[model samples]
Target: MAAARDRGVRLGRPPAALPEGAPRAAELRAAGNSLAQIAAALNAEQVATPSGRGQWTKSSVQYVLTRYDQERADDG
Candidate 1:
């Protein structure tokens, strides 16, 4: 873990809601959608992970959205 961190790699399962829903997640979050709402929206839209699973939990959405926010922060 320390070695990965030293290499700027985030250790853990990569977020499922990223790259695709990431932009939409930020938009929804900015528009005041709760984590549950965001998850529901993604599920309702039939979005799936790269593995083709459509299951989306609130925590998964939160993880993606939080990572998006952090990356945006780092960008500026």
Candidate 2:
């Protein structure tokens, strides 16, 4: 485990599942949807959240989207 950590292995509860409409959410955001609006759109599409309960909220949507965007940025 220590050796894996030295190699940058992340040890935690596995990454949460991205909501089904994540790509669409990114598209909507690029087209200028507010975080709240993205959440609403996702909810309207019946996209399941990582937690699998409750309606989508701006914060949750932001977390997922921001993490995804950051990862993408890092890859480039």
Candidate 3:
């Protein structure tokens, strides 16, 4: 959902799930790769938080993986 304000637009929810590095984490995890490896990949890719500041963390990786895992589990 979106709303128009005097300043412009505002989002009701986050634009997307996780962050840019999220897909890398999921891809590596699905390939049986390590979290550290995923972190390195994200760092190399310059993925950051929603604020566009700071690097991706291990917890973020875990968060994405867990969300994806749970979603798939729920889908079946």
Q: What is the lDDT of candidate 1?
A: 0.78
Query: Distance from true position, residue 15, model 3, in Å?
Result: 12
Model 1 residue 37 CA deviation in Å? 0.9
Indicate the residue-level lDDT of 10 in model 3: 68
Off by over 4 Å in 3: 1-16
Best by lDDT: 2
Listed in order, each prediction's TM-score against the native is 0.69, 0.72, 0.58
Top TM-score prediction, candidate number:
2
Clashing pairs in 2: none
Winner on TM-score between 1 and 3 is 1
Predicted candidate 3 versus true structure: per-residue lDDT over 5-47, tens digit per residue: 5557664664356555556678888788787777778778777
- The candidates, ranked best first by TM-score, are 2, 1, 3
For all candidates, the clash counts are: 0, 0, 0
- Residue 18 lDDT (model 2): 67
Give each model's whole-structure lDDT. Answer: 0.78, 0.84, 0.69
Clashing pairs in 3: none
Model 2 stretches astray by more than 4 angstroms: 1-14
Error of 1 at 41 (Å): 0.5
Overall local distance difference test of candidate 3: 0.69
- Two-way TM-score contest, 2 vs 3, winner: 2
Cα deviation at 47, candidate 3, in Å, is 2.7
